[model samples]
Target: MRKQTFFLLSLGFLSFTSCIQEEAPNAECDIVTCRVINLENYSIFYSRHDAVKEVASTDSVVTFPVRNGADVSAIALELDITPGATVTPASGSVQDFSQDGVLYKVVSEDRHWSRTYRVRFVPMMVLPTEYKFEYYELDPNSQKYYNWYGMNEEETRIDFWATGNSGFRLSRSSALPDEYPTVPVEDGVSGSAVKLETRSTGAFGNMVNMRIAAGNLFIGTFDTQNALKDAMKATCFGLPFSQKPLRFSGDYKFVPGKDFQDRSGTVISGRVDQPDLYAVFYRNTDDEGNDVMLHGDDVLTNPNIVALARLESPLTTTEWQHFDIEFDYRGTVDAGRLRNFGYNLAVVFTSSIEGASFCGAVGSTLWVDEVKVTCE
Candidate 1:
């Protein structure tokens, strides 16, 4: 398996600490920061302007989204390193990457160890038509982390992809992909698809009243801030989407769990579990001119919402089935705003629709593959 890494923005500036190295007692040598920039314009672009995320962690791969018509032949990058590390393709060094990617090497303070990183730039104008999740070669580190991301043909990680497994991993202890709430499955409609499931967290989750974690996947950021105030709204939804998607088509298989429980962990007698699948296209700005985004609490009721699409009812399937859901337009979309990315869109999936509130069964499972965002 190949080792691939990715980083998406979370909108908040993070404060990072660095180690002091005198070139003698130092053994750690690695790249700390990486991003693309326009030397002439003095602009730093770490996150894509077309996406709604920011770098929230240090383990993320540094990616840059370059707009068309910009200087592409010769590119400049911004990077940082450990105190004892010296990087080649040195900081602010100019290189032509219009044809191929460049590898930047960093030598540790001890001068005995080194690591190399692939510096890449991707176009932000053309959003892929759909996702198949087939290009990924999940690393061992990725297995420990329940999140999965998509990349373009150029191998640039798509910021529009995310899942609920991150929230579940906070309590679950399993490290392998099979133990994760969201993972890749060998059996699918075609190639490998993502397997989503609700699982028990042994004693840790139950002690806190969170008994089961319903599997989920969505196009948004997961904010731990909302975990206490409103766990349902914990996963912030929507992204800067340029297209007015009309229909959503995909293939899925579902098997609901046997016992149903709410956030309180109380049994709901005779209540059959239901899966949730929906999409929302809403304005990215509020009436006050400030930026806006939706969460599970407001994805359906946000005043700026132009349209919404949801599965008609609970889908209980024994085998993979092709399904399509049409977006129900509520209000007109702003033509001017659409071009400027004033509107945001999100598509969400969960084994338990009520999973947002930690309400679902433990054994519920959902397998999704080949998701397409239809325009015509």
Candidate 2:
């Protein structure tokens, strides 16, 4: 009886071991069935139909495995055309797939349309980066202007005029009728002929340092007020003198000790009745109310003329002297006391006043050239 019982017990133990091994195989099969491959960032995965598998019915749970760095952000599921072949998520998390990866069934359904799940990643950050003045040149020909190293052009000319009396003369080679004469220099370069001169008392002084170029005569004068006026009005060689008023002159005789009190030289010399004269050129103003002449007492406190170099010499027909008048129109004032007036550098001219004469004449001349204003 004891032997029989032992034999039965051994048999029972063997049976239990066999059952355990069978259960282990079933567990391994379950794991293998749930295994899934991950795919993302691949464009072909979206249209790849034969890449994935469909398992279980619509109510069954599905699982998938993913590789490292695989973007499962977007998932898609394939649908069979049969009535109940459509997929719907069941118990656990739905099978997440990639748009670029294989499609898998989560839960089965019958619809023919495929469904996809998508997630968008946050976009990367980026900074916006000084503005850069375009240079331009005003052309004398065609009265045009060009900008950006001559890449762009326009038809606008800056009106520039000669100062005093040196008239403008157009060169034969000038493309514009009113253009200034330009002379060719070394290395095929060219320069404009703009001369400045101060004449002696009597003789009409030729523009000092006049240069001829392209069959054009560039001349100027300083000294005789008439010469200056003539130059301002001249249209020599088909070049039109800028009708713009640019030259302004004034005359001031000393009031003996009163006006001459702080002056550097003798205010009144013997046998000399010194008369102060100034000329102004402008596009002739028809407004009678506008004063085109000025007087000594009127300009005594004038700030524009205060700093200009004063010309002091005996006027004669045979000799001419150059007086450089560097004007500062920046000090001109519209209205105010003598000490508080401000000046406009752009508007410069002489004011009209009674009893002021130029070389004891109604009209006189002053020569002007190389008129330049800088905004540095």
Candidate 3:
């Protein structure tokens, strides 16, 4: 989230109800938003594969996937500028995107401030068959490890890896992604692995009765629409997966907190927090042609899931241990559907088993490293 615009405005309420309103005279630095429309036509994932569009990563550099002979040479931009401010290269104009890093600028109404944005497009690459969490560069602006992509033997960045940390950082102490519960730990199986801890959501979250957000790492996008109200439904799971995974192997270390309690701070007598680890491969769409992505509530029971792998419980290890879970197929996979991206897969790890419902011990922690997904 490095290239995101900083929001400087907040409001209580306006007495009248009108969609259109007049702008303030001195609100010069009000050029609030900008977007590259028409990106879906050439982009591989406008959001989370087919689950979303337009609302996906508003990252400064957008990648457009053009085929060998397809005509994806131009793109259109849409801007929401200050009332009296001006944006160069006018909106709705089809500008050539054949070069790398196209620059767009916005000038404030009072001529006191200006903003510049760079637009970049990249051709798509094949999704890797395995994930070896090898490469990541720290996002300087947000201080979050945004890129946790796996690399193929050929040293190419795989397109299938994603995480749910972005949603988890919304209510953090400093909006710094590093302050999030899930982050990179130097002492990993390979080089750096992921550390997940169940954390207290602080005063603001307690006011809303959402006292906690468990530290989690998973293969999916965090849809903001559902996270605040119903966290179980908020973490939409799975990504386009074709591999018929047979087993999941990884190394992990876990520690339980001293006190276990529900969101209300009521202690659960004699209870020790445990980490939850699982993987699910399912169909991408339902029979009625609607997109299907499992949530915490339905993931284990969803009929769409063709196979599942869950680690055994009582995960209270202080030393790093190798763990392996076998996938048990529930039904046959349509071979033809595999060629297209009709299958979805999800891998999840949480510090607390009941973290989805905001129930957990704040200090519970889980460290994971060198995950190997064995598939057919």
Choose 1 or 3, whichever is better by TM-score: 3
The number of the candidate with the highest lDDT is 1
lDDT of 3 by residue, 1-376 (tens): 3333222221213323445677545435333444556666533432234312233232443344334344446767676666777777786677876766467676777777776666545443445544445566664456654547667667665545445555555666465656577777788877888888887778767777777777887777665556676777778787776567889878889998778889887889888888988888898888876778899899889999899998987468888888888998999989777755678888888899988877888889998887877878
Ranking by lDDT: 1, 3, 2
For each candidate, what is the lDDT? Answer: 0.71, 0.25, 0.70
Worst 10 residues of 3 by lDDT: 4-13
Candidate RMSDs in order: 12.4, 41.0, 9.8
171-285: candidate 1 lDDT, tens digit per residue: 7656465776777777877888888888876677777777777777788777654565577677879777777889988888889899898877888999988888777889887
> Which 10 consecutive residues of model 1 have the lowest summed lDDT?
4-13
Tens-digit lDDT track of model 2 for 146-198? 21111112333222222222222221222332222221112111122111111
Backbone atom clashes (below 3 Å) for every candidate: 4, 55, 0
Would you estimate the TM-scores of all the predictions?
0.70, 0.19, 0.74
Off by over 4 Å in 3: 1-52, 61-69, 74-132, 144-147, 158-170, 174-179, 224-226
